[model samples]
Target: MAETIFADRVLIGGRIQKDVLIEIDDGRIGEIRINTSGNSSAFRVPSSCLVIPGFVDIHCHGFGPDSFGAGFASARRATLAHRARGTTSLVAGLVSSDTEDTSRAIASLATLTGEGIIDGVFLEGPFISVARRGAHREGFVRPVDLGLLSHWLEQSKGTIRMVTLAPELSGALDAIRFLVREGVVAAIGHTDATYEETRSAIDAGASVATHLGNGMPSLFARQPGPLLALMESPKVSCELIADGRHVHPCLVRYFVNHAISGVPIFVSDCLGVEGEGKHIALVSDRLVEMDDGAVVFKDNGKLAGTALPLSGILKSSVTKAGIDLITAVSAATIGPARTIGLEDRGKIETGYRADLVLLNGTSLDVARVMRCGNWVVEKHEYE
Candidate 1:
């Protein structure tokens, strides 16, 4: 049966509107009516609530005790956790590993993508810089090899949507060109590239900067680095880890205010370790404590990915980062969707997929989540 949801405030066309009714049929939005008497059978959200499109996380490794290398079963559990937290779509991010292990992991995840359990795979390593590699094993970081990349791409069966590489590495420009030809996004990250090398990659079709500030060298006053190159590029979109730890809130605001190509994307880059949810002794030899709603590395007080949920990121974007609500929401929704080329979702519109979340208007807490017109997380249940 078709369902109708009436909300007093609905995010539409990048802004909130009043008295909106969204009709869902066959897992897609059928129509959107404004300023009309809602159907008698329509389900009405509280007048104090706001409805928005479900978040699209283009770069996420795992969720809730499940990491990508743990296979399909673990991936499914992670997907569930993210979905409950209002991430309706995400790419399964894979870190650097041996060729056989990487291929196996991608093959395992391809099944989940086929089943719609996850969106696709993001290969975040093997072709990265050893000097800048954060948590990835140093031994596994290698030069870009087109043959190996093609093999892994085949193993993914067209589900490998993005690959992160260091623009300064040997054959890196050629790799970016190959990825572009293969319809995959080549992202520059885990790099120690000079500005000219970074620009070369962008010219060769590198379109994204992976976890912008974390994996690259810090910027110097006299010499601009990859960060500046990524920021200045007209065609590149930068991914930011908004856990309030990976990148400072001030830089997040600066990027949002200055980014010219498009809105910066907020990615979890989570390694599936939620400090409160799972008890892991070592996340890269660093202890974690669920501190102030974020996962903090106890030793040096850095972030080990984020225990902060995507919804929490949205809240932080508004409350702490001082970003406007609509632009913050766009960073998590349409911005990442555009980065990954997913057009059917990331927006609330007629004929779009019925993936949405309802939030407590004041707190911005996720109260309900609907994916593909099916209620996944409902604060209130109907008999």
Candidate 2:
């Protein structure tokens, strides 16, 4: 069945326009007509709503009670949780674990990607640096092994869309080249690489800086680090965790303003533990309430992963980081889509997929979410 949505203000071509009519047919956008002069017969969205492209999160681990490494049922719960929060597309991120466990997780997530439940999978490690492993298990961290990577890629059945590795490690540049040749995005991260080592990887085909500042060394006054190298690389896209807890607001603002790619991609990197309403007793003999909605960690305060959703990221970008609404939306939407070579679904235009989120004009709360022309969430209907 064909349907039309009359949006009072629709974001298209990087600008918001009023009185827009979007026609949907068979799960794609059929036509977009702008400046419709007061035609109220169609299904009208309120004027206080802003219709924009659905968010694309290229680096999210899990949500709710589910995580990628847990299996298919947990992956489904995680995907659904994110989708309900307005992320229409997601890349399931898997952290470093035992080789067999990582392979199993990849195979399980591949099934969901094949079914279109998730966009793809991001292998966020065994090929990372042990010195900057963050929450990854050190026992699982290893040197870049081409045979192992090839085996994992085969197990994924071509659903592995991106891989994060340290560029300074032995054979890391060769791994990046192989990943690029196989049409997967090779990202630089989890490293203590110097400026020249980072540059070498970027020259070899690494084009994304995974969670730019985290899991990496900080900048020195005399010697530049991977972060600066990423900022200066024209071909690289920097992924930022905008949950306010991982990074400070001032640095976020600087990256948004001065990144060579013009706009940084925002990723949730959430571990699916937010809003669980449980109190955790840490090894330090302190109790922290999960209701605080912060990222989890072990007793030593070593960072695990975030608890933020994409919606909360948008709010933080605007409220805490001082980014404009449109720019923040672009970071969450088209920026990540472009980074991973997904060109079809991140924009509101003719011939694009009909994936959209309707937000309250003032509060920017997600009022409705539509994926492939089907309404997945309609807040007013529930109310």
Candidate 3:
């Protein structure tokens, strides 16, 4: 076994302590033990920085440097960029489009999965409400049909991790139940669902509320929508886009404190246009132009996607969301890991893969990223 030791003023299992040592052999965590003898020379540490577990993101469509919505090579390129940014495991999210195009994206992702890059694929729509379609193409937004979905699932060869649907739509509740029975995660989003409909969906085995507050209607003083209804579901975990543009900072703070009983996974909700420089993005065949960080469709004044990075989300989660670094990082890491049923990663512990990030100071800016014990990206190396 190839042996190595890493130590730091470590945060272990959510606590900060000194001289924490992690032993690694063959890229797996061999053992984790603390040295209380006040002796610094016992274990070899590569650096004095804090080490966090590999981050897992369940809902990033693509990274800034690459565009996946256009084709397969772009998706693979985006996946590589995301890995460099501390996303050790990710679900390649695809927006609703023509069935043929969607099939092609799935097929491309299936190829990547065979090569061990993506954990699985997440189909975000095609069964969402037309009223709350957001940036997705309305032409592609249709009611759920179990037969069609099962066929698509079959085409992917059982690699679909999650699917987002509106519960009140035709065939949605049954689809939710079917997905649950098959061990696939069903997420509720892009909906105009009433409280009763949202509750019914949860009861039917929908477990995730995708980008909870952004894609669905907000709470009313009397008639609460899917967002508040999801808050009431004990079985459902909420997905939050910590990107400051998608949600208000105060509301994010409130949700972090109150809305979720379980870990709230932070999703980027990023589009392919991101990190590719300023350009008009086509949403639903409508052109959306970005100006000074805001995306707007000139034709209708509708907001498109944000050009925000996960690092930006982490910073805002601390400064704007009133959350500490550890809690926010947990939301970004272990929360998503548990959401997708990934058993082995997302925590700094023994027997875990050494996918880690070294951030500078308290800012959470990724100065270096190591995936599976390989230094895939280093800041100074680039500088």
Candidate 4:
């Protein structure tokens, strides 16, 4: 049996330790020991690099300039661009559109999911409320119907991991129930729902509040809305955009401090304009700009997707926002992976696929990225 050794500082659980030796055999971790004093040939990680597990973006829509709803080929190309950013596993999210348009989007994602590029799909609307629709098209926003949701789920062939909807509308509770029955994650978002209504949705199997505090009513003194309800719920997980545009820094801190600890995930909520140099992405055929470090629609009046890459999200949280590095990375990695039930690829542990990213200890630049043991990105030279 041929074996190779990787000697470096490893970030396991939540701590980093030096002189960690991980032995690999047949592309699987054979053993891991901390300076066991053996003659194991060692390959050092570039100095000042920390090896962590690959990122899991549970709610990124598309990559490059192409939207997932555009076409399968376009989505595939977009996702490959996403992987180059160190997102080894990700859920392709969709915005609200007409039923026919959504149907086509789901069909296209089904093809990419079958090919294993997209792990699953998350449909974020078309059943949301117009009051809090944000950028979702008003024409397509409607009440949640289980039959319709089931149709879309069936079309995806069990690859639909999550759906975001307004929980106060007619048949919303039933839709939540049906989605849970079918093993789909039901997320509440884009609504004017009151605390009671949001609580009822959580009781009815809704487990997430999409981009909590964004896409919903703010917590008022008189009426603590969906945001407050989700923060108080023991059964719910929440999502944050953390890009500094979608939310304020204090609110992000409050969310990290209060809401279900170790449960909420960070989503890019990233619209289609990931890479493509200021090209305004189209939402419902309207031009949206990827400009000035944020994705803006119509010249800074409306917030579209984020130009915030995942790496930048982590760095900003730690460096700019004063968040603990491990906690911030967890929100981006383990939290999303578990939220979507992808147990195979989140943490740096044995028996998990070695999909990982190496980062600069201080600057947070991506030092290297690996997918299934292949060097997809390398920032340092190794002989």
Winner by TM-score between candidate 3 and candidate 1: 1
Candidate 1, residues 260-367, lDDT tens digits: the string is 464598887867653333444355445666565555667777655675557878888778878888888898998999899889989999888999999888999888
List TM-score per model, in order: 0.94, 0.94, 0.91, 0.92
Q: Which ten residues in a row have the lowest lDDT in candidate 3?
A: 37-46
TM-score, predicted candidate 1 vs. hidden true structure: 0.94
Q: Give the per-residue lDDT of model 3 (tens digit) for 1-383.
A: 55454456556789765666665667777667786433443444445456677778788777554555557788887787777767788888888899889888888887787787888889998999989988888788877878889988988898889999999898899999999888899999999999999989998999999988877888889989888778877788888877666778787887888767655778766666643235665555667776544466779876666545465567667877788788888888888888888887788787788777765545567666767766675332111
Q: Taking the tens digit of each residue's C-alpha lDDT, what string does model 2 give over 71-127?
A: 999898888878877999999999888888888899889999999999999999889
| lDDT, each prediction | 0.84, 0.84, 0.76, 0.77
Candidate 4 local lDDT, 230-348, one digit each (tens): 88877777888777777777777767766554376677776665333455556556667755456676744777657555766777667656778888888888888888899877787
Worst 10 residues of 1 by lDDT: 273-282
Error of 4 at 338 (Å): 1.0
TM-score of decoy 3 = 0.91
- Among these predictions, the greatest TM-score belongs to 1
> What lDDT does candidate 2 reach at residue 208?
93
Candidate 2: misplaced stretches above 4 Å? 38-41, 274-292, 377-383
